[model samples]
Target: MMTLSAPLLALLWLVQVVCSAFPEEPGPLSSIPTEVRKYPVFLGRPHRSSLRQEPLHIQRILQVNRTLYIGADDLFRVELDNVVGDEMFYSKKRTWESNKNDISICRMKGKHEGDTLEMVGETVSGMARCPYDPKHANVALFAGNLFTATVTDFLAIDAVIYRSLGDSPALRTIKHDSKWFRYQLNKMVVDTNAGPHGNRTVLFLGSSRGTILKFLVVPNQDNTAPNNNVFLEELEGYNPECGQDTPQARQLLSLTLDSNSHTLLLAFPSCVVRIPVARCQLYSRCMNCISSRDPYCGWTRGSTCSFLRAGTLPFEQDVDHGNTSYLGDCDLLQESYIEEPDGLVSVNLLVLSAVSAFSTGAALSGLMVCWIMTVKHRQRSRGGGSGPGGRRKCEKEQNMLG
Candidate 1:
């Protein structure tokens, strides 16, 4: 039996990419085919492209550990200290140069809120040399230390968040062969759900090469030590081929997952794009849908993929509880859908405007009739031609004139 070598395997992967269908921005929902319209619109938001500019689009901004999201709301009753999280990011300038002084220099730092990144924090400077690279900083609210999740069996002391937590520290390391090269770690995103693993957390790490790493963030149940286990794993890979020959090739600078939409939005130097979780419906057959194990997808009647609901699936509640196996009963989803511009919303608005115009016209006509009658009454009073006597007077006057 003959097996393909690494180079041959890579070449085959590239070939598959060349043959794969390129992702196109989906058309307006109204224009979607009738056969496909009934299907749910998942990850494709109203955005056609990202909001970024050239020169402002720096690839270095998307480095791993360079950007990290720390959510305080996720922790239940964990204690927090100011000293542990005082400096959010490492000094980019200090890291590249040979400075013997054990101080991290950060010229720029900003706090992100909503759609704005405000430069509000004090300029972080003259900090003690952190044991680990700030890019690998992974710590929980329970403990303010930082830890880098790696596949290597042996632990790097400088990268450990907490050296000791009794028997087991609140840290995880996976012992496996390293498939992820290009250690220029680019981004980290924390994911939390409300189902069975509600207590458990997931981390999405973007590597410099072009891969997003998924890890189950293990926190210590008790105040003592954690379960001494590897927390990170290579769960899924969305490596779209960077075809050198193809005109459209993307080198990912950053990765952000919309927890609500279950969409993975990737930022490149010049532009941004998103991966729709709803495309799981492309699995038109029951066998393929179930085997794929996508949380957002379910097999429907006639063996077509159907979206169970909007947004990212709650792993334990939706997948573990068998929501992914839903077949038929699709009518229940009729009410829970996005309205198209040329569809329901426009029709409703049109009807409302027509009704308003009709009402205004009727009101004006009635008022004009009333005003004309009032004017005629006043004129007749002045002319004395309203009552029987006034009628006789008008006849006498007509006779006189004759």
Candidate 2:
């Protein structure tokens, strides 16, 4: 018999913990054969998310040219790129030589006349921006910056390939059921891909609790409308701690995706880790793939279910490319088939949880009963023996004297 690797053992342990307490059975999602399932590939082998020597003390993190920069009180670069140029989204046209800044900007000429002009993505440096204090009693800035403040007068907003900062809705973390969404909103990432919708955009919100939520952002029916209609009905969520009933607010300082290696870097409160996005391949069976409500994922004709836009490197698309489901004229997914709301995994977890609760409750009840019996026996032994109840002042005094 061969001994298991430390990492594999650790992963198995984590699975037991997370899977056993799953909120509900993953329904059919978890019912597929293990062979057909795209089990996660452990890129860093026994890849743990929070194992850093120093405490994760940053507020935000950004990936530029394969370098991960963190922001909290200050911005600092982490220079641990095993494969250089793996995490950045854009190509560097020129070498940067600057003072006081390590992350350099590679300028691209504007293609359209109406496009917002600036050094990088439209915002110019050193322009006097009206800094209005939101906490101020009554002062604000809205109309002067724009040609007009009227809702009808449309203002063209400059955006990029990333949906996180593009024309999307306000980030809402609450669930539809009114249960408080447990994760603390830390950072957001937009995954651009071709979808059935048109230009597909799925937003990934990282929380302080180490959970990453997959959200769908659909614009209003009117083309010119601009207000976040965030549909918190998520397809899947990843919590690094796995199966923790109430996960602590362990902030993910930043998230970086390595396109070349198909890896993802997550900076947590305790440590930083690299996980393979290739392993996150959600669908395998074509039917299941089509059934998954994940917007950035799709089932190819070849029976391969992966990211909808995986093959397109240096992926070029108008900022609004949609999901593959649009192309799938497949049947609508049944309520039991969806993975987001509930899964068969949750049922297993619930059963284990119920048993655990009952066991604990019974143990506590037995202890309470024993304590009560002991107190009753002691009272009978005392039998009005002036134990401060005061049968009579003289009798109480006699018992106290005895």
Candidate 3:
């Protein structure tokens, strides 16, 4: 019999003792109420222009009541209604596109009966391009009274932010003095409900280094410029390490703000990160966990936790198992659930490790016993065979007697 070393036996016994002490988690009961989790909203594939070979650049996001406004590369603006359905319906009545050279603005109206949006009104600006380049323009609505757009340009290349006065004929401009190479005006969050008299702030993603830059745009009483000049002020900036090259960074493909809390939700390839506006400076981030009040964190197939530099929350339970398909990158907007029928439920790592070790010990012991038995049987068979000399002697004695 194979004998286990003292240390190995003790170790195996300890594991078994611990496993016995810790009871297996009970299965889900029908009587218990499970909390449903919500996921980040993901829009469909970004719209790109045929004129340019570059993929569509989703430059800015504007959330107005129940509608979402999207600004993209090649001067395209799209509006999506906020409703639960297979395909998000776009408003066909209001859409705009600017010319390639940044000369004129084209306003188009769309009609949507069910799911299809058809173009209706198409108005082109008299000027082929705006006096400033549209490439650098960022758009925002301020105080429900004025729309402002700002631009920061390099050399002859201009960056502009455009704000249109709802039905008014006038347009406002907020110009940037600093030299900029490449930049993306990503998102705008208006904290009207928080600040005095509903102040507005805009968030943008700077190119090359992927810096998150924020700007405050408001009505300026001291207007010296002709374009109903609006004041543009820099609020704050953060480098999410999101860049065009790094896979982890690139996964931060999109961002949006919670309408109620104004918390920023950054969508990545694997998981979504949430940065509360109050704690933006500290870079305090929270990720979705298998069990968290935060709508973005939850359990799915192949679910795993990646510790942020700040580590995880104390109460947060690390995910132990599940497929990540429900947590796909480009599809964060869809809601998910941790149903009881979704295969083996998650378990504690410590428990699993201990069980595996004990099973391995048992298997090794059985193998040693089998080997010893086989050797003993072979020895008995050899002893039963007669020697050649003994057999010859017996035959000679029998011949003499005869």
Candidate 4:
């Protein structure tokens, strides 16, 4: 019997719709591997008797063509196919000496080594300096540059991108807000094929808070311009309601991408999860798919969402604008979602609720009036002694007595 205010009813409706759209306890989408192979790539010891034994911590390892480039206490390279099986992989590796004592090799001097990777006379003099300190698992090579996303000091976190220019390497560094210590960035993966042109460098950064942030780095055609890196979005890796014991358990340690499958792998302290690079399946309807504004997804002719690859004809997508005008007379548009702030509702819902309340009140009022009138009519009929029949009976009784 309670009549809720229009605004309150509208807010309740909005909450219900949003909750239905995105469930709190989401169902599982994929499975994790129960078993994986473990292999040791490198060993750290006093290389044939030295004065000191420097700790060997590999910061990053990347494979290009057939060669595997490693960033560790010293820059190392080996054949990718050779680093497998038993003790046969160990060979006489050529090491380069640097004048700097604590040199964590984060970049390679390709020109100095040239066609012949001569061991003698080559040094770590012309290589780029290591951008990250305590450099362990904080570097990525993407689009011909070395990128590091790590905490520089106690209060500063930075994402530095650098590359070698000519025969002599010069530093071309772009730091993404060193002063921004909101979230400690753990690891990063760069994707150059994010857009149609394949020039838009998209960085997927894993943070310490179990979150992956996507950034779109604008190409610096003019080197003098300031860095134009745009923050795209942040994806949640852990649900807070799952009740983790410690914050360390939620930290993401590794981020890797498989281009052939278009899958992004995330490694945490507790488990490893694989997610699609573009989640097109979430958009079940045509309107949702078209409005997602994701370059990697589209609504296909099969009436399902799928990856927008080459020869994917008759697919609907608008990455730049998400314009729905292209979808002429879409029946699914009615099911489109509307996002509103909490404790607030749209004007259309408010008006509808007000009209509904008014109609309900009017119906109740009419029912009350009809009930009262019916009761009064019954009382009047009873008092009149069933109309003329009661008067006739009284008269006949008096006549009989006389």
Using TM-score as the measure, the top candidate is: 4
Higher lDDT: candidate 2 or 3? Answer: 2
Candidate 2 lDDT, 152-217, residue by residue in tens:
111111111111222453232222331344545656766554243436565666665545554556
Can you list the residue pairs that collide in candidate 1? 63-186, 64-185, 64-186, 64-187, 65-135, 146-161
Model 2 residue 234 CA deviation in Å = 5.2
For lDDT, the strongest prediction is 4
- Give lDDT: candidate 2, residue 193: 46
Candidate 4 residue lDDT tens string, 43-123: 322232433223433455454665544455565555534544311122334466765543534344334546775587546
Model 4 CA lDDT for position 144: 50
For candidate 1, the TM-score is 0.30
Model 1 root mean square deviation, Cα atoms: 22.6
Residue-wise C-alpha lDDT for candidate 1, range 1-402, written one tens digit per residue: 998899999999998898786654322111111222222211111222432122223233222232322221111111111112211111111113446453433323343567585688677321121323343344433234433332221222223223322355444443333343334455787656522234435566665444455444455567688453222323222222212312122345567766555545555433333443334445544544554444445554433456655443432223332343453543333222222445455443566799999999999999999999999999988767567898888899999999
Candidate 3 lDDT over 6-114, as tens digits, reads 9999999999999999855332111111110122223333322212223334554555654555454333223333333222223332336556655422223344577
- Comparing 1 and 3 by TM-score, which wins? 1
- Measured by TM-score, how close is model 3 to the native structure? 0.25
How many clashes (backbone N, Cα, C below 3 Å) per candidate?
A: 6, 30, 34, 0
Global local distance difference test of model 3: 0.40
Candidate 1: worst-modelled 10 consecutive residues by lDDT? 74-83
The CA-based lDDT of model 1 is what?
0.41
Per-residue lDDT value at 244 in model 4:
52
Q: Go through the candidates in order and give each one's C-alpha lDDT.
A: 0.41, 0.44, 0.40, 0.56
The runs of at least 3 residues in candidate 4 whose Cα sits more than 4 Å from the true structure, single-residue gaps closed, are 1-182, 195-201, 216-232, 239-245, 333-402
CA displacement after TM-score superposition, residue 6 of candidate 1 (Å): 33
